[model samples]
Target: MHDASAIPDAPTASSPRAGHAKAVAACGLTTALTWPIHDILDPVNTVMLFLLTVVLVATRWGRGPAVLASFLSVGLFDFFYVPPRWSFAVSDIQYLLTFAVMLTVALIIGHLTIGLRQRADEANASAKRSQALYTLASHLAGAMSIENVRQHSASFAATQLHAELSLWVCAPDNTLVPATPDDAALPHQAGPDVARVMHMVHHEHKGVASHQLADSGQLVIALPLTGSTRSRGVLLLSPLRAHDPTLDRHRPLLDAVTSLVATAIERLHFVEVAHQHQIEANGERLRNSILSALSHDIRTPLTALYGLADTLTLIQPPLPDRAQEMSSAIRDQAMRLNRMVSNLLDMARLQRGKDAGQLPLRLEWQPIEEVIGASIQMLGMALQDHAVQVHLRSDLPLVHIDAVLMERVFGNLIENAAKYSPAGSAIHINAEVQGDTLEVRINNDGAGFPPDRLQEVFNLFERGMPESTVPGVGLGLAICRAIIEAHCGRIEACNPAEGGAQVRFTLPLGTPPTIEPESEGEDRT
Candidate 1:
């Protein structure tokens, strides 16, 4: 909202129209005749004509014509109505006092009347500005998009200021990125120096004007768009003339427009960020639902297969050699199915944070080699055909973690490496302590992931090879991320220089506990 009294009224150009001139001439004629009849006409009547002439000058002829009418009234009074009529001499000194008092009164009244009129005009202009600002604010508040707001603002600015205007928004690097101006002939491209000037004004929350622009038949005014404590961008308005009074008069209104634009841009930016977060949350929920359905539908058949395989192995007569092979195949297939179900259930549990009770972290002085060996032993079947190499340092310190979850972390990574790579490819697992954290790298000799899918691969059900004929549901790496993040760690995937994908993760290393000295033995020392 704008204060009406703060707005400045613009001075209109002096009108030279003939009708106004004719009206002033008519009032001057009537006053000339009435001044000569003071002896026949009442003195009040003569004073009334003089006052009427002052009103005409003030309202129609302005200050110059009004002053001229005052002198003409004095001349008419002296030449015709004063003593010794039709002569330049006065017969009485008392009449001189009458002349002096009337002239002084007329001049004083004219000056005061003009001043009051000027003040009234100023007030009216101020009221118009307040209305314009209020209307602009209302229209912008209901805008649905930044484009709509920009267009509305641009048009309003041009119309109100009577100047060609352009708006530039700030890029991420705080550079002035100009919007496409409505006028194509005007240079829409802002140069490097112009951008620098705009940035300065935006940072300083000030206005910018240069004589270079003024001399070039164009005047550029950079008004900073600031909202609250943030500077949203800059508004560049180009007026036609260097001394355009209209533009100068509307400076406050322009500031109000810039403020409104800044507020809108900030509002729209937050709205977009919130919308994106909502989409991610919805996607996470849908992925969990699908995984749940898959786990339930696949587990029933797998349990039945496991039971039938065990029954076949215990046939009354020893099963034929071929039958035993078939039974073993059935059991292996059932185990693979069961592992898939377990992966789904584990993913659901990890995403929901339901496994917090199962993986209680116990801090102890334990060798990195021991933890690595435990993880490998659990993934033995998955890595049966793949050559696994460990590169653990002998002097590596023990890490504090939930031993069970850490094993699952390594199990998932190694399994993912194997699943993506061809059978017999070497899978290298290395752990090194680097500056207050332990960095683990799992590298394989398989075809690397597509560059575009590097980050997407971690999203649930998003596979590096979306159309691959692989057996898993693409939840392995996502589960790996959830568990690692739960442990206050970070993980990322990249293509290695050796033509395979490398998955790296970091875990913070706490101080290893020192072994307590053995208490004095119960046996005699």
Candidate 2:
């Protein structure tokens, strides 16, 4: 790697720098050799030789060495090449001007040359580091597992960082462990408290920490392995020289290495998560298929059982009072079971990937009030104890929807309210045309949803009161959301200001048809 800091600082007289000595000696030797040529050439031409020496020193080294050569060149020229040879005094005032011009011109040329060299060195170093970073990133992108990340990261750190390297991964239990267990015999052993520091860095997700190693007392740096959102782990580098000046200069390269490693680790993490999700999805699909098949088989027998129970009450002779009551109970339980079966079947249909995308729905313009009344009647026994109040705007527009599915939405919401609310508490249904859409709300005067769990109520198998005697696997609200969204609408649940649970949904109010009157009796002839 090219290090821009390798260019020497300004030379001081107290410090015996080798470059300064070399510059001064080269200029002095050239001046001595030019002494023999002094009688053969003009003194003005001798100044050219000294200027050439200064330029060479400046290009090869830097400003410190170039400055030394400049002063030495002028001194040698005045001592030997001037008219009064072997002396500092000048024979003519004109020669004094020559010495001044020679010194000034040499210093200026040396200064410019040194600046150009320094800039070129900096550009070259930047390019080299950029290439290194690009190469590391490419390799990291191909990394498929945490082990691959560990190997690539460690190798780059060892080669480019010039320090002993180790990657510490934050385990699921929050313990810090070596990225590769087998590579534990590396140079530095971390302190026991290093995990605490790693945890702090990962949680803060900012800044690097320097710690003293336990066994060797060597300084090591711990930088957070930051993904796009969270921290992955910590990168620990050891055996960095104490008070090293160049370490700060290479910080950007170190940061690039951290970014590449963090990204690789995060990618591997999500890949594992996706694989697990796919497996779970496959299992869920199988379970739904089995439930759907069983529900289909049971529906026929359940219908028969309900019919036979009702038939018992219709015997030629009037049945006994107890028998009539038993038949009513049987019918009610049968209806409840059938509703559950229908919900499961609806879930299965909605969850079918190809069906949701390709299956057509039976949709038409219909009155929302009709769907609401049908849902209430379907749940007659269930909501018999609860009072239902309907508040609808007078000019409610017709909504374009699949009537059967929209009825299901109202049924689920009303049934959920009836089940959760106290007996005889009123369930309120309200609707109005708001702009180009119709918004409907169903609220129950009962204990509202638990704090901050309004959205969780719509997740499959999630319950508002999980431990309560309420009989549901929590698929109702999820189904309702799916149906409403399929109609290009939105649904939301919230706690009302007056203490109750409110579920509101909306659907587009499409343009209604207009009928025209026929002309009076024109076609009678």
Candidate 3:
């Protein structure tokens, strides 16, 4: 921040500040020159010359000087220019009338001249300030970032008011940090006290906080950068040498400055957000395009490969032991690859469904246990090594869900549990009624998920052990989350205290249609 000093004033600024001495000198000079004109010129003509002197002083100097010149002209006219020269006494009473008229005319001309000059100076100052404001708005409109905004603002402040400035922008959490990254400290290098004040300014959402340094009487102002939607931050202006009256007078200019700055900053903020969103949107479209194209392209040949391998073992005359094992291995790898491809296709489909604002659901009221059983049957051999346990309360309520999609959810979770857990470990499935929803939990006694990555595991391609040689590309949990959310349910993963990972999901228990019993008196078909 720079030191305080006022900007250069224009030409008219000097007029109103004229001293009494200058006014007296002008009057004295007029009288001395008129001493020579006393004998040569008529007394009335001499009075006219004195009146003109008063007008010049008023226009050049200001109101007070003009009034002083007015009085001096009258007295000098009475003693030196009247009939009884060098004396205050008058020869003819008519000359007294001349003196009275001269004084009255001089005062009126001086007063009017001074008022007109002051008005003209005021208008010029206002126009200059308005032009400065217009220039500032132009610069701010083209500002690329907060740094650019602060730079232009500081330059304007220096040029217009001779002040120093810095901008502190608000973070999402309502904390203030320096808008300029070049600032070596956070909100304030000045300390926590100043930081608190800056935070307060941002929180208050309106008005400026000001203080005058006792030593230098320099004005420091903290102005809120309030945008249309929110308060963006604070703009700090400091070390203004202008006194209280000047600040009060220029307060509107400062407000307009902050308003312009706030508008520019918010525009930049949204532009950055829009640019980022566009990039993400482009990337997502590309990923989905690749996934859809590859999945469809590979599925045909992949199915043929799996069938050929399965046929090798089923032939009437089996191949040699080594050949048989190789065929089995080939079949197993193809199945794994097929599952991966199916996952990619499903992911792309779900993404498209979400963009269309709804998932494709053939929803019905069905027993959740049926979906669980179907999922286990579908993954028959995969869960052979793990003991599967299903614990459902006898009074479980029917849930409204897409039966096929729910089955996929259970299957993905069960298979994921088996893949991540040690062989022969029990994968626990439990369901119970909790309030208006049915809560279900799938637990596996593996090392559990990484404590820090429990939530992240559900993000696409975020594996629990990223570097570990897991046989998955980490799509199962993400798919599960998308399905559960589409059903208007909630899902979360956590490590249970029992030393294993658990995925819990809840499905809403809607009002199921009543099932009427068969009427005993029904007519025969």
Per-residue alpha-carbon lDDT of candidate 2 for residues 151-171, written as tens digits (9 for 90 to 100): 776666655565666787777
Question: Quick one: ranking by lDDT, best first?
Answer: 3, 2, 1
lDDT of 1: 0.74
Per residue, candidate 1 scores C-alpha lDDT tens digits across 186-279 of: 3233333555677799889888865354435455678888877577778777764445666665677777888888888778777888999999
Q: After superposition, which runs of candidate 2 have C-alpha atoms over 4 Å from their true positions?
A: 1-139, 142-148, 165-239, 243-246, 353-359, 513-525
lDDT for position 235 in model 3: 78
Per-residue lDDT tens digits for candidate 3, residues 1-525, read 122223344445565455567888988998898897577888778888899999998888777888888889888889888767788898899887887888889989998898899889778777777787887899899989888898888777766765567788878787777888654343221333455566778888766544432234445567899988889998776544444335445778889999999999999999999999999988988888899999999999999999999999787788999999999999999999999999989888988888789999999999999999999999989989999999998878889999988998999999999988999899999999999999999999988889988889998888888887769998999889999999999999999997989999999998989889889898868
| Top-scoring candidate (TM-score) | 3
Clashes of 2: 0
* C-alpha TM-score for every candidate: 0.75, 0.66, 0.81
The 10 consecutive residues of candidate 3 with the worst lDDT sum are 1-10
Candidate number with greatest lDDT: 3
Looking at model 1, report the run of 10 residues with the lowest lDDT sum.
183-192
Any idea how many clashes model 3 has?
0
Better of 1 and 3 by TM-score: 3
Clash pairs, model 2 backbone: none
